[model samples]
Target chain A: MTTWMRLMSNDGRIVFGRVENSYLHEYESLHAPVPTGAVLSLRTLTPVAPCAPGKVVALWNNFHALAAKLEKPVPEHPLFLLKPAESVIGSQQPIRRPAHYAGKIVFEGELGIVIGKRCSNASLDEAEAAIFGYTIVNDVTAAGLLNENPHFPQWCRAKGFDTFCCIGPAIVSGFDWRSARVVTKLDGVERQNYPLDDMVFTPAQQVSLISRDMTLEPGDVIACGTSLGVGSIGDGATVEVSIDGIGALVNTLAVSSGEAEAAAAVEGAA
Target chain B: MTTWMRLMSNDGRIVFGRVENSYLHEYESLHAPVPTGAVLSLRTLTPVAPCAPGKVVALWNNFHALAAKLEKPVPEHPLFLLKPAESVIGSQQPIRRPAHYAGKIVFEGELGIVIGKRCSNASLDEAEAAIFGYTIVNDVTAAGLLNENPHFPQWCRAKGFDTFCCIGPAIVSGFDWRSARVVTKLDGVERQNYPLDDMVFTPAQQVSLISRDMTLEPGDVIACGTSLGVGSIGDGATVEVSIDGIGALVNTLAVSSGEAEAAAAVEGAA
Candidate 1:
């Protein structure tokens, strides 16, 4: 299995790299990965969110175990949601809670499929070929906001907040996901431990089906829906999303102060 | 009113321009506009989507008329969804029907708010200040897919296909949106004609509330949702989404052949 990552070098330049042992061999782009021979110690570089995805497509209720637990009927097609690219944050980044939202922040550990090529209306074979690698995703959601309004369910707003999507550490290609498992650790306690095979739709099926609905561009992530053990994370708590072959993605939750202050802080830090 | 547009110049480059009568005076950028003396006939330039938005934050049931018609409660906050940037197509582009979806395609005409600044948890005043201009959005959806799965509502997939979002012709600033109306035409017959004042959440309120959930970046669009006349478009049907101040966005629907063929064709064409 090959591991890939995008990291900020000691010189402060963001570059793609193929991780081997404790060294990072730099590459120009993820699409056509070829090492540039600019090697660095993994400790010397800061890991950023690996993929600059055009969009992060997340599934809902695509897990057989979750459906059974919720007592809901299995869906024929993959029901999904789009989390804005702005919601994505790398491992070690703080998951800033929206200042206006005073709700339960839930951590959902998911296996993410990274699309390697532009795929639309693709067959299962083509879809399988399009899979670049796999990564771990913490699909964070404001639980209170989901059903606050009786008229309409606020799925997007409840989950599309900034820093709501925590992904990375590395993308692992050629990993056997069938026997793999997703484990979510909240504040050092194992909260979720589910088999990847519990998914109602397999990775190939998801990629093919979703590609038919929309164009899956290079680097776009399709988060295979989470199973059980989905629970809330308190403010200042640590959440870790882990898939064995693909390393763990860890983030801390922090409630924002307010409008001007948080906005000013985000901009200032940028 | 100042009309802004992104048009394909004679040199095949997409550039921003200020529209005045039949002429387009080129601008350096939309945020801080400066005329660049590169004037061309509006007829000579091909109008593309007005903005390259990071995300299209679209509302659902935000119109009072629609809520009343459906006997649904008026939402206190704007219930929204994110349409990927890939779905966006410029005026006159064809809306490609997904190969796997043999469903009804519907046209939703709505007023689109184009944001001018990066805003997070913004106040009404700050939201109002961030409003760059107004445009028309054709929030297209695969109507049949919306409720095919009983367990989950397919909002994102139903509306996120490539070329599902059609917007542009122009973005008009300093216009009276309160008095304006959205008019949708399918095959030259007007189907939807609803007043803009029927919105449950005003543009300012939507911006402010939505910004609290996620940052609204410059050029990002907020589709205010549709009212009474939302219906389906057949294969090869022409649909037009229009607003008085923000011109019209016209598109044609075409059914895809199949998976391998369509995927190969898309890749070849690209």
Candidate 2:
């Protein structure tokens, strides 16, 4: 089933369902449930790419397993990483793997926190107030590059390929973390599953730690690290990364020429 | 004299001098020659910290004499370096030189660009439109940090100290660069001066070259590298870096208070 979001009016007077299109709610229309119509019919279908984060400051590997794979102990401090801003995609969108990435592409399912408030050096107690909500992230990894040469410099060129990261659905404002779960699938085969509580580091600590170095700006994204169930998607494969409390984001791998053409044409014309 | 900004309003008229009182801009009455007032007149100046960029991409040895000092050929493309956002400071700010920074600190004066748009692989022709305006930047350098120690990471721990980079009194939207000059002074003695055209890499090329691999976001910053004639400010000295068409940024070097207690209190109170 395709998943969408609902939110209460700021005054908490009414519930609005089948809100804005895509999942990240920027503009939404309040509507009652329709007996049988696509979520598009809910409104004019003002769809959007997922939360267009101002910047995606990711952690290299906040997960213990990822640490073990890299032959390191849990970090004394959280590592800083970056994925380009253009990487986010919403539900039903394809994961458009770039041909340059070819065999190196892999998927990492992660729980991402969406910052609602500007926060810096936020304490564990102040963390909740700073978090506007949480969303699911497919922290797609380019293992082929790592497999080719595990080094720091290659990551930007590797992980920053146009569609390497896809985040989706509206943020669930108050997700219960204790038993939250994440699952990744390729063509309906479940490849990974783990309870959120299983993480060596907690979300509270993640916020508290990251705030130490950089002031977390509003709309700055923080992607929780992924589990080990990562693999390359064969050409033309359909992939889905889902979180239990929220929703699933399904995407296909393919080349994207039209957008580049559009940008080129726009530039040329301008 | 305190510097103030003048920006075009939505109606296409010039609006000038809004005191940034803690994030809220309180509109002021005058435009010409910045007004003078006691620090107490404004409730609290919005800590206009130097706009710490997500990245500090610098060009290496772009200056002629500096190129000779390093015994390296001036690069065909701008050689970029990264500075953590922690290093930036705002108007009237003080830069603390920790004892840990073993070498003498020198000042590099350059034209600073405050990005107002996000562009990837942007052409040189599109550089100006991507800028909100231009400001003065003191690209403070730590000779001890990386000078002879080639293994040490450039700028990160050295130039990326708290308050190392300072920008502004105002962001001048339209400033001529063709016949401009930049100068750096320590106390009453002029240390460095060079015509704007002396630089090996032009600002337009700097934007276009760096945008090839990475994205430049709105509010991101770039400090055009300083020219030759850098001299010693040594210990316990005050330095002023300025451009002919723009204003000057003066700062004194001292030690910092760790700020951990302040951060902790701010966190607890956030």
Candidate 3:
């Protein structure tokens, strides 16, 4: 398997590279990665999300284990939501709590499928061919805002805050996902450990099914739904979502002073 | 007041220009439009969406008339959904029906707020200053797919299809939305006639309130929700969403032969 990464060089230029040992061998592009012979130590560069997605489509409940736990039947299709690109942040970036919302913030770790080509109404085989690689995603959300209004479910708003979607480290191509597992930890304590095979719809099925609903562009990411052990996070808590083939995606919840002050005010009022 | 438009020149170059009587005066950029002394006839160029939005945030039940008609209370916060950038299409572009599903596709005509600068946690006054212009939008949706699953409301999937969001004609700066009315016509017959003043949240208020939820980038669009009349359009039907200050955005529904064949197959199976 090949591991690809995107990072900022010491000279402050964003470049794509192949990760090996302690060095990142520079490459021209993700689709056509021809080595540029400019090798840099991995420590000298800052890693970013392996791909810059035009859009991020996230599944709601695509895992059989989760569906069974919730007592919901298997969905006929992939139920999904579109998260704004503005909500994306690279791994190691802070997941900032919205100052205006003094509510419970949660962390959900899931496997993210990175699309390499433009896809629309693609067949299952075409969808399989379109999958470029895989990465880890921490779909951060403001849990309290989800069901606040009974009339409409605020899926986008509850999860579309800045720094809410964390993706990164590297994108691993040709990696076997069926036998791998997604392991999530909070402050060194293992919170979630689920097999990727528990997914109701495989990555290819998701790509094909979702492509019929909307066009999936190059660098677009489809985050497979999370299973059990989804829970809230406290301020300054660190979250790490790891898949064995793809490296871990680590992020910390950063509750700003303004948010803390607002929370205090709301608590005082209450 | 300035009317800005984007178009594909006959020479096959994408150009931004100011719309005058029957001509387009070319400009260098949308943010700082420096005239290029190249004037082209309006009929010579093909018009596209006035601005390429990074993301489109659309409201729901934001109109008093619609809220009262549906017997729902006015929301404390804006109920919004994010439409992917790929779904955006210009006026005169055909709205293609998804081939996999034969569902009731509805049209919603609403006022669109174009953002001029990156805004986050903005005050009401700052939000007012950040408003670059207004435009007309036909927020198209597959109404039948909205609540297909009783548990999950597929707002994004139902409305995020390719060419589902039509925006354009021109972006008019300094337009008076309060005194304006959105007028929609389906195949030359008027259907929707609603006052913009009946909105629960004004443009500035929407910007300020939503910025608190997520960062609003330059060229981001906020679509004020539609009111009263909303109905599905048949294949090949023409739709025109118009506001007084912004020109009318007209498009026709183009159902592909593949969709017709699939519909027939489903009917035959039934």
Best by lDDT: 3
Rank the models by lDDT, top first: 3, 1, 2
For model 3 the local lDDT of residue B74 reads: 95
Report chain B TM per candidate. Answer: 0.92, 0.74, 0.94
Ranking by DockQ: 3, 1, 2
Task: Tell me the TM-score that candidate 2 gets on chain A alone.
Answer: 0.76
Where model 3 places Cα greater than 4 Å from the true spot, the runs are A259-270, B259-270
Off by over 4 Å in 1: A10-12, A255-270, B255-270
Instruction: List, residue by residue over A1-270, the lDDT tens digit for candidate 3.
Output: 989899987788898888899888998877666799999898888988888887889888888989999999989999988888888888898888898887899989999999987889999999999998999999988999999999999999998998888998799999899999999999989999999999999999999999998888877899998999999889989999999989899999987898678899999999
Compare the candidates by TM-score and give the number of the best one. 3
In model 2 chain B, where is the ten-residue run with the lowest total lDDT?
B38-47
| DockQ of predictions, in order shown | 0.72, 0.14, 0.83
Tell me which residue pairs clash in candidate 3. none
Give one digit per residue, the lDDT tens place, for model 1 in A1-270. Answer: 999999887778898889999998888788887778788888988999989887899989988889999999878888898999889999999999787677789999999999999998789999999999999899999999988987667788888998999889899989899999999999999999999998999999999999888888999999898999999999889999888889899999975566547679899999
Better candidate number, 1 or 3, judged by lDDT: 3
Which residue pairs does candidate 2 place in steric collision? A94-A252, A104-A144, A116-A132, B50-B89, B50-B90, B58-B81
Off by over 4 Å in 2: A1-52, A82-87, A94-106, A140-165, A186-200, A229-238, A258-270, B1-89, B93-110, B115-118, B128-133, B139-165, B170-201, B212-220, B224-239, B251-270
What's the CA RMSD of model 3 in angstroms? 3.2
